[model samples]
Target: MLNKYPLWKNILILVVLAIGFVYALPNVFPDDYAVQITGARSGTEISQQTVDRASEALEEAGIAIKGIDREERSALIRVTSSDDQLEARPIVQQALGEEFLVALNMAESTPEWLQAAGAGPMKLGLDLRGGVHFLLEVDMETAVEQRLEATSSQIKRELREERIRYLGGDLSDGNNIELSFRSEGDRSEAFDIIRDRYDEFLLDESTEGENYLLNLSLSEQEIQQIQDYAIEQNLTTIRNRVNELGVAEPLVQRQGADRIIVELPGVQDTAQAKRVLGATANLEFRLAARQDAPRASTESYPFRDEPERTARLEREVIVTGENVSNANQGFDENGMPQVNITMDGVGGDLMTRATRNAVGRGMAVLFIEFRTEMEQEVVDGQVITREERVEETSIISLATIQSTLGSSFRITGLDSIHEASELALLLRAGALAAPMYFVQERTIGPSLGQQNIDAGFMSVVVGFILVLVFMAVFYRAFGLVANVALTLNLMLLLACMSIISATLTLPGIAGIVLTVGMAVDANVLIFERIREELREGVSPQLAINAGYSRAFVSIVDANITTFLVAIILFAMGSGPVKGFAVTLSIGILTSLFTALVVSRAMVNAIYGGRKVESLSIGGKLANV
Candidate 1:
């Protein structure tokens, strides 16, 4: 009764093993080299016909096809190899046209039944899958300056609304928003405005001869808060953009106060990765030039959607991009392409006040982009790599305000629905609170990834075989049973990992190897206990039951402590360490299950019901 499993316990153990087997079956099938087709912009969807066309294009190119699928806003086509996938990109692109994006990728070929059962292969990490990694530094100065400019613009408008006069647009000199007023009354009013509405700022007022000078700046605490928010917002925005790249597993997170780290697994092209993830663009709402005001356009003052046209607008900005809370692409009442924009509280308040008395006056939505291009430079007789930040601005829409606009507004005059959709995507992703340039870029080649995989796999296989042989030879029949349980434990671990879509890195592989050894450790403890009981002249039934019962404490104590360590590691670590912690944790749990539940069930089946005078666990002498 001690080591023997009841019918329900037996069923439970068998059921868990069966579930593990079911889930782990998917990994047997190999993934296919694939090409992904999607709109270059976010909102563009791929149709079934598009998938068919892609398949046809592959066929016309004399490329072998495996399968195809129509996804939410994208499509995928499967091929036989990476070479085929690379070859098929241009062919598929030509068929889909220039606007549609074609990217080479990998598609899992797990069977439908397996997928329906929530079974899939483990997600590979960047090192395992050969991808791009970038370290980006946020331009904190730009962020602070932009905030100052917006504050200056808002103050200028607020004063105008209150009938308080200020000389020229409020100027920002890095540290302060300098406001010069003609009267002491105006300066006092500005200080009151700063206190009441802009409580985050500190105001300093002085007399510059006949004029009252007020310098407004954010408090130290406020500046620190802004910098922190800028980093976090940039994290969210970068994640949104990288996801749009259709990456299977991406890491986009803040590294420090002003830096972010981006890791994309299975992304092959460096140029495409940089373009999609690193390209910086945002929007600005400015008042258009009036008839009485001088309207001038230069070649540089161009429209983004329609570059042939030039943007003519006043110098003052109404709203910078940070306050955009949401954006969606849709047709207007008259069925014109437009992007509906929604603002946060500050932007809403600013827009309402800025346009309150300016109805019938034109407003321009200008798209600003900072593009980073790497170029070689000669410095001190040495060739060095340098990044050039080229700034470009274009007006996408100019419309007269029919009503006083608040947080929610729309930008019309887009050339096509595609342009509107892209604009909406830009707004939805939000403008970068700060400009970012890649400080470090690394590309892991596919060959090296494959080599890592081979080495990791070989280590696991070799460890498994060594453990298997030892268990079989030392424990004899009982050793073989432990080995069986050990194998099933591995299966369960992999199944759990797949179910969670966990990313497996090299450290994860090392965790699995560690699990393999520790898994058998549990069995060794139990087997030794049984041998000790046999030497004490107990019947085989009594020995088996007592061994399992008594060994349970040691197994639980050892595994639980290790599991706790894994939890701590997972909580405190990042990247590869976290992956290692994940596998170790899961492995500990699975190993315990195999030792207590599975190994016990096996021993009970073999020697539980009937009493025996002897046992054959690679040990001989038992009294008859």
Candidate 2:
């Protein structure tokens, strides 16, 4: 039989299995781990004393702290624990303060043998281990408005540069623009110029009286496309930022037409996660109110803007967050924790100019508003009486400016160390579209996760035993061979999943069970064919070869269709559906190998080059 087919036939199976195992080898190892500790309360900083205290506390709790290092505002501690004695959050938080972050089971921490073998802790899905999940809706309306504004600005700039004679028009409103030409012919020519030159920018256009109204509204289909593109871009940016934070298996993907879902499992600091996910770091450097400017004369101002007074003040933004180079947590001159920021070349020049002009005057105030639905309602209700009340203000000092701002600005006055750190992280993560409010939240304790793991393992064990027993009793010798192959197939599948960092959920386990049954079906098909050939008085080798050849096409066709369905599910599904698809796809591939190649190899080893009167056991003609 081996001599009859192409040598590449067996080699293809070998290569695939080799690739899968090679990819999976890394999942079999242990990992290195570290713990970061910091002060939780406001105005508190981590020092050597803090580190010493934490070490003592851990030691008292029967946890042996091996090495400890204290930086300016935080500490890094290293320790080891048995698999059953993993560190608990309460004990660590009580000792190191609520700001402490612990990272355990790192791949690099495993022993050399285990590390090389790709063994480590099991990966948990977001549903099992509570973390942060974000559903961000892209503001397509705002995007279109911005595009219109940009188009208007470009037109103004180009006309000015070209010295075109035209009347000024209101471009900010987007719906209408008036440009009185020098003559009727010039008006027509100007309209043609804009309509032809800026076709891509214009959504729709019409002439009303002497003005051309460019309808800047995007179509529904166009808006949907833009939303998708934005979601993809945001996903890439978020993925990169999360990777920089050294997180493992962070899932970032588009959830719907305009929303994206980000899941970060094992992220305990909800505040920190929110900061990273919500910051739209749209920094702006506007001139401060001058010292000689008239004061409000009272602590509170009316909600409605006093246009006569407010519009008289001169204000302009010199730069924005786009010019920022980097931001990090640091300390002010008074030894208070602050965010250290740096700017790029253009931003540094702009900042220097702005600072030089405002040195003797009041410092620039930073406005940070976390707008949620409730906040919006409150602001809107007071719009007629106290519109200004909606704005929140925090002031930084010249000393803080000098220490923390170097071609950049630090936003201080944070209520706590965690808050300050989170602010820094937000700046570092880049700006978000807008502040996100929690619509729903949930947390799963590690204890519950452990319980779930135990239940899932028990189910798999029981199912495996039942299937093995059933196969052996029903098909006799052939059943025994199939069962062994099935067992090995499971090990290989798990090894492959771990290697690829594919998550395993409960639904994924169901996929594995289904694959098991399907694998048996394939073997049953081949075995029954071989039995038929044997009853026709064919030799053992010829019967086996004919059976496999006849059943191969059917097994391939069935599994291929299933594989296609799994792929479709992966493309359109989320969360558990995705996990199910991943496991199903992997299982199908493994089943094909185990049912065809592995079982065949075992049979060849047992009955190769041997004459047999009958391929049956227990004299029942071996129900195949």
- Against the true structure, what is each candidate's TM-score? 0.80, 0.60
Stretches off by above 4 angstroms in model 1 are 1-4, 34-104, 170-180, 183-236, 239-259, 269-276, 285-304, 309-319, 324-344, 351-366, 375-386, 395-430, 621-624
Q: Candidate 1, clashing residue pairs?
A: 3-545
lDDT of each residue in 184-303, candidate 1, tens digit only: 998898789778998887888888789888888788888888888878888888888876666755778777678999999878555557655777666788887766674432123587
**Top candidate (lDDT):** 1
Which of the numbered candidates is closest to the native, going by highest TM-score? Answer: 1
Native-to-model Cα distance after best TM-score fit, residue 530 in candidate 1, in Å: 1.2
Q: Report, for every candidate in turn, its global Cα lDDT versus the true structure.
A: 0.82, 0.59
Cα error, residue 446 of model 2, in Å, equals 3.2
Candidate 2 ranges with C-alpha deviation above 4 Å: 1-52, 61-88, 97-110, 117-122, 135-261, 269-272, 283-431, 435-441, 616-624
TM-score, predicted candidate 2 vs. hidden true structure:
0.60
**86-199, model 2: which lDDT tens digit per residue?**
563346667665565443322233345645666544466655443556665555555454344445555654566566666553444433334544445545555666777864
